[model samples]
Target: MFHIAICDDSEYDLQEISSALQGLRHLGICFDETWYQSGRALIDDIAEGEKSYHLLILDMLMDSINGIETAKAIRTYDVSMPILIVTSTVQYALAGYQVNAWRYLTKPVDPGELVREAAAVLKSQEKSDETCYVVQSNGTVIRRVPLADILYFESSLHTITLHTMREDIEFRGAIRDIDEQLTPLGFFRIHKSFVVNLSHVRRLSSRSLVMVNGDELDISRARIQQLRHALMDEAEREHISSHRMRS
Candidate 1:
């Protein structure tokens, strides 16, 4: 799914954009749209998100903030989002370069043009379905567990405990040893003794990373980037595909 955010002071203009988006739906585009009245409001929403906004449709002029400035600010957090600037005049089209505008549409933007641009954006966003990791335990009682089901792994005195959806699996191995095998599956060693699944992460704090199961794992400074990428929210398209397969 494409997460679209539109900021326009004039409700009429917002509706026009919304209608064009609905046109995409008429053509069978399944996505969601978020509306904002002004650039300031859009900035505030982006501030609260742990992940980057994917697409933004902005009106060039607002009383409080300019669309170009707003896009620049959003780019401060993430540079890859596709930004579409809407205006009656192309006066600020050149200014849009500051924010890496994907396209600039004039007032009375054609529904076909808007729909076409958005379709291209969505196509670019298409990613492979969610990936699952088949985790296997050692010894006579070997079991398989999906990576998404595991909350976090804890390293003990020469043994690792996998806190999972249904049960805890104990294996004779060191945290470092298990981490080597889990990294390819999106697991990160946040702390010296903890290997966590990014999908199950509830939140990441200065000292710990929280899991959906309410368990907290220690976070080491060295692993912050890896943890952030892992804990970031999954895309809607990805979320759907991830649930379709059981590992």
Candidate 2:
């Protein structure tokens, strides 16, 4: 199921688009929709990072800001998300082209076109590479481990232990410093003492992150979003693949 958003000021237009989008359900598509009355509201939502909609269906001419300008703001953070511009006529179509939009959808949209465009964008999200992380130990012997077999990372008074599904390694260092190195590798620092392997994460929330090994660790409130993207989403898919392959 692809998460989607239909943003338009006209209630009548939103209703029509919503109904048309629901029809995609028949074609094995499920949508998580949000109705934005204006492009300004949608842009603010993106800034807060709360409402993340994968596919955006925007009307070209809005009351406050136009869809073209609104898309530029969203592109600042999400350049890859597919944008489908719904315009009244082709005259306004060229304006949306500047944003590098996925498709120009004719206003009073066609059901067939909507379904096809949504499918194409959603299919592109799946990743082929499995992700892997190399965590270096700051000890007498320089050691690094594959992130997949890692259950979690624990920090004591002055040492951090890399807990794996098989074994645990103890190192004398700050977990904070190690976190910087693992940032690109998909390890999220859930707690001050723990930096979790997103791939090994099974269940997670604002309070805690549960590893595949069933070990529970506290989650920092500020890091909840990053942790969510890592574990529950495809954000961790490639990392898991690389680590598992190396093991």
Candidate 3:
């Protein structure tokens, strides 16, 4: 089931957004939503770690904290989840980009536009859910972790650790073996000892990559150009996909 969080200082606006989302059900999209009156309340709930949401719909203006600030905070916890910003003016559109917001809508929002954007985001998420990495040990499945949750993989002498936003799992494996298996699934062998999920990467420099969790991993000198091409290709594909969705 898709989980969504919507935050608005005005109770009326919250209800309107929620009502707009209900229109998605006609398209066979099933989801549950949580409502918050302020950005701080939404941030507090997410920090508690009890819930994970696939999408966030935020109002730009609010008391104490605004939508952009809220999105910035949430990105530290989850870099991949899509955030949709709702506001009254177009002036905040540039600010939305800084937080990597998926879409920005002006209010009072049109229900049809909200449905279309929300559906596009949720459909992409559903596609991601289909591709999961199964962690196994001694013929037993240890865990079936969704690729979206994994930040990166770290390899030591004889142990491979799977690092996610929540916890780390250690298992016996070779980094090369993992690279061969996961490289086809958006994972990159940035260094001999590290393989990172490209989607969770926040910043990439010539020599290192900063992951969503603030961990920096070295990039092999030999793979720098190839990695850059791969990133460019991914961005192009995403652009095409977004265009198709909007069209």
Candidate that scores best on TM-score: 3
Expressed as tens digits, the lDDT of each residue in 88-165 for candidate 2 is: 989988888788888798877998888788777766543311233333332111232445567777999997788988
How many collisions between residues are there in candidate 3? 0
Candidate 3 per-residue C-alpha lDDT over 1-247 given as tens digits, one digit per residue, 9 for 90 to 100: 6888899999999999999999999999989898989888777766654445668899998889988989898777667778999989999888999999997999999999999999999899778656877655664433457877888999999999999988997888889998998888888898899998887889999899999899999999999999998777767777898999999
Model 3 segments beyond 4 Å from truth? 133-247
Q: Give the whole-model CA lDDT for all candidates, comma-separated.
A: 0.74, 0.74, 0.85
Q: What is the TM-score of each candidate against the true structure?
A: 0.55, 0.55, 0.58
C-alpha RMSD by candidate, in order: 15.2, 14.7, 10.8
Using TM-score as the yardstick, the better of models 2 and 3 is: 3
> Once superposed on the true structure, which residue ranges of model 2 sit more than 4 Å away at CA?
127-247
The Cα error of candidate 1 at residue 44, in Å, is 0.8
Which structure among the candidates has the greatest lDDT? 3
